[model samples]
Target: MIKKVLSFAVIGVSTVTLAIGLSPNTASAALGDQPEVFHSSYNPGKSTVTISTSNTEKKPVKASGYLSKYFKGYAHKAKNGKWQFHLDGYGDAEGLYNNVRNDQTVRVYLSEGKEQGAFDVKVKTIVKKNKVKKKKAIKISKAINGKNVKIKNNKRKSDVITIKKVSKNDKITIYNAKGKRLVQKTAKGNTIKIYVRQLGKKAGAVNVSTQKKGYKESGKIKVKYGRE
Candidate 1:
């Protein structure tokens, strides 16, 4: 009798199912609102960790997070959904940056109510001692009327070319058109004389370069005079 009893009832079963906490599997997560972290970075110099995240819904919410084992803190969220965690030394913030190292990666955990996330962020490399300012390219100048200046007439029969941006200990080397080493000597000053006649007026090029005490030699530049 019970198996055959298919009687019509009120259409409140959906409400009854909801009363029994039987939410649909396709139901939206966090009431269709999810949080997302789009960008993050840690600045070792300023002791600041910043993030760009989103709260899927329109309501603003506070977020709490921690940076590995360093410290627990709350991030300040801007109206535009940007988050910044400043750990400048102040009471519990002291030593927050002391243990952080350049290029070292650390774990980050964040939460905003039902939405939470975690990821690793690397600190930017900023070693003051390891940074080497790249020097400008060395341009071979020439003595123009006793004043060292860039060689204007590259086709002249000048026996000497000025070399600037080099040390006295640097070595200057001269080469013939056929890559033959003509002469090399310690740089004396801004101007040094070379045997331009070494080319013998055969359209040969006179190349010049300099090498620091222990570094590689600079590129050889052509400065040979035209045929006589």
Candidate 2:
């Protein structure tokens, strides 16, 4: 009986060892030492960040951390048998780090699906400021003769007429087909917006004109009723 019990115990130990060797989870545990590698870049003009990974794993990767708040990032497989991650709206990071004017150092953490550990990457990038050009003043006589006014007409209510490239103190006049002045306004800035409600259902051809300090009395610009 003692010999039979010792033989049963040895058989059980061997069976458990064989099961462990055949388990997929146990096999994957042996690869825990290997981690994925990544490269990252930032473009200020395009407001994008791109990451390329060395691994071709089918699982998706995610990015997070200080810079991640300003960007939306996703991973996909590249043509070169590697993984590529794109981060959009990277220029919004300037709002996250208000004190960073020219260049910044940001941290990003990347992880695979359901993975508890993440790979950390530090990136240094330059932030460029966008320049806005001012609009030049429009030649009053040329605009009026060429009918360069932008009109937004409302059938049942007041119509809005906008004259761009105007200077302060420029006078805008609206006249009916019979040469009766309907409304006259003086421009307050580089552009003048006039809401015309005096037409009062008259749907004939109207005209617009402008007068400036150094410019001649502009030629009439014919305007159509209820049209921009």
Best by TM-score: 2
Model 1 bad stretches (over 4 Å): 1-158, 161-165
Q: What is the TM-score of each candidate against the true structure?
A: 0.29, 0.33
Q: Name the weakest run of 10 consecutive residues (lDDT summed) in model 2.
A: 94-103
What's the lDDT for all of these models? 0.45, 0.52
Model 2, residue 109: C-alpha shift (Å): 99
Candidate 2, residues 1-228, lDDT tens digits: the string is: 111111223644552222222355554564453334333334211222333342112431223444344444444455896444443333433222211111233343323222223223333223223468989766655446434576666667888777787788988888878888889999999888888784555455678888887776688878775643
Could you give me the TM-score of model 2 versus the true structure? Answer: 0.33
Q: Give the candidate number with the greatest lDDT.
A: 2
lDDT of 1: 0.45
lDDT of 1 by residue, 1-228 (tens): 111212344675532221223244434442453555432344221223322222212321222233323432233455986444332222333444323334555554434323234445444322123358999776543322222223322335545445555556677787776788878878676555444333463444567777766566777777645444
